[model samples]
Target: MKLYQRLHPGVNLGPTDPENHEEAEEKIFGFWIFLMSDLVLFSVLFATYAAMSIQGVALGPSPKDIFDLSPVFLETMVLLASSFTFGLAILELKYRKNQGRLALWLTLTGLLGALFVGLELNDYRILLTEHGAAPQTSGFLSAYYLLTGTHALHVSVAIIWLIVLAVQLATLGPVGPVKLRLMRLALFWHMLDIIWIGIFTFVYLYGVVL
Candidate 1:
């Protein structure tokens, strides 16, 4: 047995039907391509945010004026925890094959994700209503909303997807198709965590410091 397979015995599921394995590999490869495209999209948004951050804040609230670090920090931790729970869910699905435990982890992950989105929207409300940092106010605020809003949108969709997958798991158990879908969801959820880290560092940290 391979080292990883030995370490996590049930995960590898060695010597599957050849045709099914090929199809699964193809779908995963396609998902990787989609993720690469998403990376490009985020790269453009980050560059725009950087360029605009300095240009139009003189007449309005700066990032420092509107960013509440406490909430942002809390949401970041929440998202990180969700990712960890999702990892546990995968372990349960692959190793233990325990339906109830997997569903519990998935539910917890979805709740954490929803909380992150809620906190983010609250941040937006504070900026727009209290500090007058609406997208129409300045380039900085516009770019800020666009970047963060796009990420928030992604998380919202992910939460919906999680719900659907949980339903599937409950109905179908850990069959091949469900397992494949869960693998894709895992990649996606973890990807959002990474993107959030970048946002916290680049937008929030740099915005406050510089």
Candidate 2:
């Protein structure tokens, strides 16, 4: 049991026995598996978007016509900043063990994420109202909405998760389960940032250039 525990320092042995340690490992591993499944789902969405985007504009405005780079740039900056803030919160929790600092950083991250979502929705609304770029109007618009809307949905869920995590940190401090949950959330936020980069480069930048 000691050997197993030594091999896996992340598993909290606390007052519980080896069984609890095994359970903790299982939980973390299970979460990773779930993340893998999510990756597959996102991959499918990306592929579909790519396939459909070739015919995206249809009779509506082309990507270069209605796709404004300014708001997309802002949204990208805010989300990337949120990811950095989340890293700071992780640092505070892991090293400083300061619940107050962690909570503040996390709150900032959540606010930034919320700002990104708001900007995205506003951008979509502008496309619909000012540009008449509704999803039903063209194949390109449909793919555009699906791809970006899916990402926006993930960001929304992450914001809610951040709120719940902040409450947990306040109530429980940096306990084992809380730390694990925070780690998972960090992974999620970072993944979203990476995915957004792909979107920015492939979907937006390429759309504009070609």
Candidate 3:
């Protein structure tokens, strides 16, 4: 209820009893802490990636060998575009007073996101089968799987969340609680964009140059 009060405009769900905002503020603080914890997890995984990158497998394909810059770059563009679209969606929700625009943009975001996932999965399958670059084939492949696979898992979860949020908008019409939750989820989606940019630059681009 505190979240509902703090975030929603003119919809103070907080208690008139003068004890509600404190609880909401605490929940917001806790959620931020949780977000930080997740960031730490990603940082550790990135460190592991850096350590294992140089230690390639003896007979297996390395990142440069299996990674096609064109496709990965294209996937990056798609995700980036989706992030921008989601931002627009949030803006429309906040002020334009139109749930339809928000929902339309979000649906577009989901489609773009799903397309990127499809391309990645296709690339992975090709690398494993035609290129013979399975995870067990090399340390590089193992790290590749660990890093990209984790990102893919997060993308899948976000897609599911997007679908659920779409339904909420469809039913609830971006009224109160759902609007704030959607904003948070949009932020989460954009956060993934930040991580993907890091992966693209460091993991893919740097690997290609190396």
Q: What is the C-alpha RMSD of each candidate to the true structure, in Å?
A: 3.0, 3.7, 4.7
TM-score of each: 0.90, 0.86, 0.85
Query: How high is the lDDT of residue 57 in model 3?
Result: 57
Error of 2 at 157 (Å): 0.6
What are the clash counts of all predictions, listed in order?
0, 1, 0
Candidate 2 least-lDDT 10 residues: 10-19
Better of 2 and 3 by lDDT: 2
State the lDDT at 34 in candidate 2. 84
Better of 1 and 2 by TM-score: 1
Q: In candidate 3, which residue ranges exceed 4 Å CA deviation?
A: 1-29
In model 2, pairs of residues that clash are 56-140
Clashes of 1: 0
| Residue 18 lDDT, candidate 3, scale 0-100 | 33
Query: How many angstroms is residue 97 displaced in model 2 relative to the true structure, after the best TM-score fit?
Result: 0.6
Query: Model 2 has how many clashing residue pairs?
Result: 1
Q: Residues 33-128, candidate 2, lDDT per residue (tens digit)? A: 887888888888888878777855567777888877888999999999999999998777666777778889998999999999999999989998
Worst lDDT window (10 residues) for model 3? 9-18
- What are the per-residue Cα lDDT tens digits for candidate 1 across 31-143? 87998899899999999998888886657778877777788999999999999999999888766877889889999999999999999999988887788788988888889
For TM-score, the strongest prediction is 1
